[model samples]
Target: MLRRVDSWTRTLRHAKPSSSESVRLVVERLSHEGRGVVRPGGKVGFVAGALPGESIEARLVERHRRFDEYRLLDVVEASPRRVTPACPIVERCGGCDLQHLDHDAQLDHKTAVLRELMSRTAGLEPAVPEAPLRSPPFGYRRRARLAWHVPRRGAPRLGFRQAGSREIVALAACPVLDPVLASLPGRLQPVLASLRRPRQLGHVELTVSESGDGRPWPVLYLHLVEALAAEDRARVAGFAAAEGAYLYLGLADQRAECVYRPEPQAPGYLLPESGLRLTFEPGDFLQGNAAVNRAMVRRVVEWLSGDGVRRVVDAFCGLGNFALPLAAAGLAVEGYEGDAALVDRARRNAADLGLDDRARFSVRDLDADAGLPDGVDAVLLDPPRTGAAALAAALAARPVPVVAYVSCAPATLTRDAAVLAGAGYRLERLAAVDMFPQTAHIEAMALFTR
Candidate 1:
């Protein structure tokens, strides 16, 4: 499902080239995915790693009836906006595609991408936000997944997957990693190298949660193919102590064998502003950036409460992120989620906070359900990348005064926005949040009112 540049290379290598020779062209502009666009023979050429206004000799990799793709060979002229990437292994990491582009310019490209997508897909051009909600460009990620690889006879390695390939790019520290996890890959070398069956290791998940006292506590969840031996557990626990992180071991097929700190004392993060601390399962989904997520929640409450919305439904709500905040403000909130485990967690969170009466969480699939909660004046959506297309259509027939949509996928967001517009709702405010600044991903919160 994930697209990669290596797939283009493979297709280019297998197909017969229109000509044995290649052509040189100037990059016109960048596409939404950070590829440079060039038109040759009336066919759009997507050149990865090439910037606009740069001249490059590209080999025709694939030729379709309407357009073609190219592999960048050599740059004859470089764009002035280009600069050296911050990460030494940026070429292989594939995690940050816009690192080579100027930092400030990346923001511009993202904003432009958002605007273009809205116009093309949603048929409405939203007014650009005054500026993107941003934080430090680096060291902002509080969650990361590292792939583990071990050759038949070579030393085992831990890091991220290579661009367009399944191979692992070994590394010690990543610039964008949170401080708690920045040095973990290097520190795990001894553990991975000494494992009895290295092939049984899968990957590592690093998460940082804020304690009740406002201190950051790092947690490590190890994904293994087989059970961890008694000796191996001691070794892992020792490694966790040395790294100042709590450790948890989970097997792919064995749920009963999964072990961590214990029940009721799981790793958790606190939102002091809302007077709430949420504990999530290690495998549950949470926003990657800590600072941005808090700000996003605050913004959502501000928007939802502006028009005196006393009753609201938080669709696709996970762990009561939005529902709890709104309920705290005296609004009766009904949060709907597909995962029963997360719904239980959300209910438990409300009960712990003494808001169980007002903050009600239900387990239901938003994608499948057509009818929404009754007696709600407003709706808050935080769906996955596929977007809330079905929910948006359902709400169209029953218009509300306020609809606050939080989206990570601009294309799908705009598509849903179009549906909401047809239902007499107009876009009121749009704020771009740099959830993952170094990468091309952009998260935004938009308000639609009738």
Candidate 2:
């Protein structure tokens, strides 16, 4: 005789749900990536666009051995923190997530994720949990790359990529971009559609920098899959001239050629709080949010300031964003970067600010085992998403008094934090920074001290 199987037991015994099958589940909490987590018949389900403490009906989109991914069909119960997104195409555009959640709730979620990662991965907690560094929720992105696509039977499409797909979501305006660039896509679409060879256009990079006189300087870099005709070039130049924006063309060899510029000077931004100006090229790496970047720099200076902390080493320093400010705070700084061009730019920025005597830059492979500098009292780490694993191991051998780590990815940061913990360093301070406001990206700062 077969044993009686209840509905829940039937679900557990069955294979993966079909793509069209809809399941009603109560969300337990949010995952690190901001997706809602639920357990239906002991099987984990990740639902996008669902919030914690809410019930939702979702359809299975993808299946995995241990868990399943679902797309939200309807919110059976809505959370109080939910808000209507400002962007019309937010559901389709991959530019940002968490826009449907309240801005304050987003900050709380980021901070909780950072703390949870530290505890779970590193087995440690900060002695001082500092308040999050925040900027305006909208209009905070100063740099963006917009995609261009030309279909077989339609006008050229230009905007951000669609969520979880290669299809381009054509957008007229983006609210998260800086005011100078918010309406640029709408203006550029008509010009691009007018081009004889719009299919050859790959993408466009937009950057807005603030001049010393507080004027907005807009720069556009157009990537080309194939060379444009003479008339097409002239038309693009005329559009740039009319908008009073600098234009550059990206060649096949990855070189940028300036096509039009109203001023003789390169584009740059001023750190008025630090009393310094930094200039960068077309493809240079920069912090996307200007306000949070400045505040983060100031916080780093404050954390490393002391008579005991005289000499500091900045690993993975990009164009002296933090090193120059530390030097201005009366500390001797030695910055090492992997990019020779960025190192040269850092050196020039130091000299321009008259901090060359206090700050120095050198090109070195950070991934290799290069030991810490001699007589270094403190170290500041700002590595990429991969984190500074090799450097962390090297620092463990010759530990410093203070270590300040600024990370854009929390998982890697926790992995490196464990290395520091093994070196007898105590987690002293931690703060989550709201660099990318509407996205699920977490930027954090942690201080370790021996």
Predicted model with the maximum TM-score:
2
**Could you tell me how far off, in angstroms, the CA of residue 1 lies in candidate 2 after the best superposition?**
44
**How does candidate 2 fare on TM-score?**
0.94
- Per residue, candidate 1 scores C-alpha lDDT tens digits across 186-251 of 888678778766666788888887777877767888888887777777788787776667677888
lDDT of 1 at 278: 86
Q: Quick one: best lDDT, which candidate?
A: 2
What is the Cα-based lDDT of residue 370 in candidate 1?
54
Q: How many residue pairs clash (N, CA or C atoms closer than 3 angstroms) in each of the candidate models, in the order given?
A: 0, 0
Q: What's each prediction's TM-score? A: 0.91, 0.94
> Which residue runs of candidate 1 sit more than 4 Å off their true CA positions?
1-22, 127-130, 253-265
The TM-score of candidate 1 is 0.91
lDDT of 2 by residue, 1-450 (tens): 222211111112234557667777899988889888999889998887778998777777667999987767677777899778888788778877788789999999999999999999999999999999998999988999999988898878999987766778887999999999999889988998899888778899999867777688788989999888888898889998999888898866676888998677777887777788898878789999988999999899999996699999999999999999999989999999999889998999999889999999999999984678689999999999999999889878889999999999999999999999999999999999999988888999999999
Q: Can you list the residue pairs that collide in candidate 1?
A: none
All models: lDDT? 0.80, 0.87
